[model samples]
Target: MPKEKRPRIKNEDQYEALRDQGYSKEKSARIANTPDQVASKKGGKAPAYEEWTVKELYEKAREIGLSGISKLRKKELIERLRNH
Candidate 1:
């Protein structure tokens, strides 16, 4: 026999119907909350790490005796600074 297809649910009411019929909570949540609808209101931006100025990075590098400060990228500098 051919398999029965599940209906697409669009909103909270439809989700509640599915839940009442014994669908898993995970599945019900998925149907109710799409990625675009559930995306963070912070506009999907990651938090910026505390950035050190070039001079500050160099000073920190020197303070910690890091030998490769001049060749390091900003991220690398931040990592090295953190480790120190």
Candidate 2:
């Protein structure tokens, strides 16, 4: 049997729309109608530490003074940001 293809989400508006509808990032990406959409929702190759609005993550990163924050993945960024 052929594998089923997953849809991708493109653009911030679409991503926001899914999010607004109460879809988590992972779920939204899975159901995105296109590959581009999924990529866009993932925040691209660039790290999206800045995209986070959580006060703890932001404040933690600020406290640590970690440079090149954009390169860190979500988990690493969260940890370092939180520890800092």
lDDT of each: 0.68, 0.62
Off by over 4 Å in 2: 1-9, 33-84
Error of 2 at 21 (Å): 1.0
RMSD of each: 15.8, 13.0
Write the residue-wise lDDT of candidate 2 on 1-84 in tens digits.
974554445555776688799876765665454665455674447455666665656565767566777666667777675344
The sequence of per-residue lDDT tens digits that candidate 1 reaches over residues 1-84 is 974455555577857887898876656767576655464445446333354477777787888687968988878888876554
Model 2: weakest 10-residue lDDT segment is 3-12
Estimate the TM-score of every prediction: 0.37, 0.26
- lDDT of residue 21 for candidate 1: 82
How far is 58's C-alpha from truth in model 1 (Å)?
1.1
